[model samples]
Target: MTPRDGARISGHQYGAGGELCLEYRPDNWEPQFTGAMMIGSAYRLLSGESPSDGEVADVASAHRQTVAQEVRNTKLRLILNTTLLDILVEQPLLQAQPFTLDEHWFAKHWLAHPRRLGSPDAPPIWAAAPPLTEPRTREGFAIRLPDETNVPFEGSYAFLNTILTALNFAPALERMTASDAEMPLLLVHRGTARLYSLAQGTGSRAVYVYRTIVAPANEQRLSAEHGVLADQCVAIVGCGSVGSKIAATLTRAGVGTLVLVDGDLLLPGNLVRNELDWRAVGLNKPDALAARLDDINPSTKTIVRRLLLGGQESSASTDSALQQIGQCDLIIDATADAQIFNLCGSVACAERKPLIWAEVFAGGIGGMIARSRPDLDPPPYAARRQILRWCDDNGIPWTGGDGEQYSLQIDAEKPPLIADDADVSVIAAHAGRMAIDLLKGGATTFPNSAYAIGMAREWIFAAPFDTYPIDLVPEGQWGPDADENARDELGGLLREFFPKAEEAADEG
Candidate 1:
């Protein structure tokens, strides 16, 4: 049927089906009268009678169809959209507002209702049944409406739009119309209320305050902090799991600009722990990570380079990339590539920019954070040498170690020593945490130290004794009474490794 015919049928059905009222509150008297006339003309058109004004009648018929289509489309859309909005808003509101749900009502009704999408095993959307109260809390309304059996038109669009426009304003009703993938009807309503309140008032209230309690003073502080970070820039190397996470976390944290460098592409194997999905497969790692980061925080600027640092192919661009890296306030090394680590460390130290080095063992059991503050002298090569010496002494292996014997041995002692995709997520999360701490300079349990957590065994340890200024020697050093006893414990091992050198020193 033609849209006009459909509208006439709908209008006739609506008027006869129930007690319907149409009120016109136009801004001016002329418009109010005109609107009333239009409604009368629309009724005549529905009854198969043409009005006196041919032009007016034609316009009225068109208007009726447009309005009817919108109302009809909204009914189905409202159920799905509102449900999504309720889910998004409830969590935030329960955390911020004093709201409760009628769980018994929901469990008995909506829980078993086939209309509700998502897994049945998923936790209840509402914690408890909403308390009986006027001017419902944001979360209370969001959750309670879902369980309401008497919703207008079974929570359909036509009924929702009518109620919304009648109770609220036309603008408010307009905002409720969003696409399927967007938030639900109830959330849109709440968001519109919030936006209206903020636009009309002091502009200090939270945009989603009904979902969460946020003070004006806190908002001001956050704004100021963002202003400071917005002008700051960072450079991140090695867009692997840790690097990808660091990039994403920094973007979310409001780092103004980011430079991402990586030599690989997303592969099926990488999806095990990486933030990217299968769609990102075949995409450059740096580009894929940068896109994801931007998706989360569009305000952050990103520059991606898909080339291995210091490689023959990257030789010409290396200088330019290093110059950009030099300009950043912070340079992060998450590649776990020894060569790249040394190169970035050298450049950052030379340029006097703060450098953060993070690495997770193949299985993510052991990770380390090394930061070279601009004010402090560069971390001595001694630490890197010490690591190398330890690796040699312990006979530890690198990624993709030899067959079953080596793998079995490391698994028994340090399950994380072997590269595994499962460990990527753990490494990413830990690396992001460490990077944030380094950037903010906060007290951490393992600040400037290497930490090893055995996931299988649940053992935690901080290496190198967790001492500060391990590189510095004090002028007034005093020996403890048991110092000699402590020395004796290492005497045998030291002598065994340096017998001739110790004898020469003693002779001198």
Candidate 2:
């Protein structure tokens, strides 16, 4: 059935849009979904036919969860912090308790601008059921029903009057509504919660309750089912377009700690491919990325090191930053910079850490992801050299040298194809997946340590999604080969730095 303009109807499972929210689609559209059938479903629903199981479950779920809500007319916000949620869950039904109405409570709980607080024309009334403070708190009442099956109130006055009558309290509905004091009535059915302000000046005005807490076991269950790396530590060295994205991906996957090392500022042009936006524009890349990571998962701790590796930075700070990167379980190089890669290679080899790096090819055509594990493959530098050799052998002109964002700046003959954010994200996400695989340990997803993934038709890629797995031969030992005499000299320096535990104990 077609809906008419500005027409409102009260019917089962029908929203303001006049479309039936719940219905069935037949396997064959032509024969099963005729006009008669469509009208039959609507008629049954409007005539008080029982809603399908899916519809009943949807209502029950919505009623149990407290999400962000707002008053349509007054534009007042309803806030429910974790503290209030805990009390509400512990005691489903509570008599009218003291609640405070103030603007300061809203300011402290949310991240809104002062000028944009509440409504624009006038100061909006804010209320907290269990007032965050005690000095200005007032008495409030609330109820927690088993479900929303038999409640019968249509407006604010009716709701308050009904609630007071059921609780056998002296009906003060008039006194509560006529005054400026905040008497918020919290209605909870099963787990869903709604808040109605008695002093809102509008009938049936319930401010939406924005529940500000996540269930603890919800994240754990999600991570456990997906083999999440919740206890692993990872270090990402390039908080650019690729680096920032990798950081966010890992954080969202429940990685416990991330060491973010980047020595650059988020520029205006970086928004094209960078995960960060204008809010982070002048901030240091690592600092901004740390904040972004926090927004994704607050439990994921971040150690930000704002120092450019292999640059003209102070030697002490550079070495300190490298030391932190070496301590991580896995290291990812998203900088696409040779100098930074070289420094990371040195740290990865010396610390016996796993390394994963990616480079998006010129234009958004494709990218490469390479990894070097301690005993599984050659060192980071050797693995990279082999990737270069594979490119040479395949007659694919290497297009990864120019230090640009996402892609290299090719000559006039082969004009560089500017890669969009999606192109960079593709490679970055693969790098993040490889990082997770390394952190998880044991069986790996990528049989080959290096892969050239094609996003578009270019270079060796004949069509999109053409993946070439380059086999990297692990040649020589894990660390650099040293002469016997030089090794003896290095042993003496190492002994000076770290004495035997027994020797130190004896000396003490």
lDDT score, candidate 1: 0.49
Q: Tell me how far the alpha carbon of residue 473 in candidate 2 is from the true structure, in angstroms, after superposition.
A: 1.7
Say what the RMSD of model 2 is.
11.2
- Residue 302's lDDT in candidate 1: 91
Residue-wise lDDT of candidate 1 within 99-119, one digit each (tens)? 222111221221111123222
Off by over 4 Å in 1: 1-228, 363-365, 375-377, 380-382, 390-418, 441-449, 456-508
Measured on C-alpha atoms, candidate 2 has an lDDT of: 0.66
Error in Å for residue 45 of model 2: 9.2
- What's the distance in Å from true for residue 80, model 1? 16
lDDT of 2 by residue, 1-508 (tens): 4357635443433346555543653232566577777877656555444355434322221122133321222334444454444555555353543333333344245211111112224553232222222223334555565564455433346656666666665534554445555565566655555555565453444433322222332324444534557778899888888889999988887788999988778879788998898989999989999888876777788999888675556657877998899999999988777757777877787788889999888778899899999878988767888888888899767554343543222245544337889999899988888887777766988899999999877789988889999999966456543122334434453354346643787799
TM-score of each: 0.46, 0.65
Q: C-alpha displacement of 285 in model 1, angstroms?
A: 0.9
